[model samples]
Target: MNDETAYKVLTGTEFAALEAGRFEGAPVDLADGYIHLSTAAQLTGTVDRHFSGQNGLVVVTVDLAALGEAVRWEISRGGQKFPHLYGRLRMAAVTAHAPLARAADGSVELP
Candidate 1:
């Protein structure tokens, strides 16, 4: 698992809603009080458990360095540590983004 960086998977529509250099985050994030992030090793499980059978999903790579104190490592599902951001996600902090596409067996590749 990567310790230096994290990823945020969002729908294409949610990604398009990002504006003014910030992302409002998903509804789950709002309810939880932080933007949930996934590690490279956890990406597949996150999709399988929460986003199964979905399409047009976008995976965003976030620079942990940019989040500073706003980011927290929290224990979540399966007792794994997940990155959580307390504030709006800054678009400038994203390094790259790509569509989440599945291969055979319905598994997706992280973009």
Candidate 2:
């Protein structure tokens, strides 16, 4: 969870799977009933906690405006507010994306 609204991060394979008109969601997302997105500050923790050791990852900056009502800010880990998409993520909702590469400090840079 984070204080600011930042971009989302996903693996390349996950992004490819999102190519379908409706992104059903990742395994965790499906189990949780929504798409999980991480903000800039939370990105590193997210990667280390969930996506570490994974390659070909991408940082996606999605259009929250496009998501409209589908996006909801809710309290998750550590009681911080996080954006959750209750519905399928449409491909058109994404605005930008880039490789998830770590810096010398081991933190990843956003697209």
Candidate 3:
């Protein structure tokens, strides 16, 4: 993938797991065999569609380069390519994280 970074939206519980050092995967990701992540352009849609009405949400910045071959670009969600990690999401691959924030235009503000 050309993009060097992607974002993961996590619940409070998931964030806690990640903060502890590593995240094996979310339930969906566990079943799917990969961790789901979105590009900056796809962030708002991901939140609106899958995470609506949720509280205590966190946005995590993942370094795709750090993930290396574990990260794959796959076609998903309206035919756009998304980043998926076939391995655990470790803190070493995370660049930053913060509570989810949106601008007046409704786009997510990256931490």
Q: What C-alpha RMSD separates each model from the true structure?
A: 1.7, 2.3, 1.2
Model 1: per-residue lDDT, tens digit, 1-111? Answer: 666688889998888876345468898898888899998888888988988888898988888888889988889999999988988888878888889976787665666
Model 1 has an lDDT value of 0.84
Q: Once model 1 is optimally superposed onto the true structure by TM-score, how far is the C-alpha of residue 31 displaced, in angstroms?
A: 0.9
lDDT of 2 by residue, 64-108 (tens): 777778888888988877788888877787777788878998888
Q: Which residue runs of candidate 2 sit more than 4 Å off their true CA positions? A: 1-5
Ranking by lDDT: 3, 1, 2
Task: Write down the lDDT of every candidate, Cα atoms only.
Answer: 0.84, 0.77, 0.91
| Per-model TM values vs. the true structure | 0.89, 0.85, 0.95
* Best model per TM-score: 3
**Clashing pairs in model 3, backbone N/Cα/C closer than 3 A:** none
Query: Candidate 3 on 2-111: residue-level lDDT in tens?
Result: 49999999999999999897678889899999999999889999999988989899999999999899988999999999999998899888899999998999888887
Candidate 3's clash total is 0
Q: Of the candidates numbered 1 and 2, which has the greater lDDT value? A: 1
lDDT of 3 at 41: 88
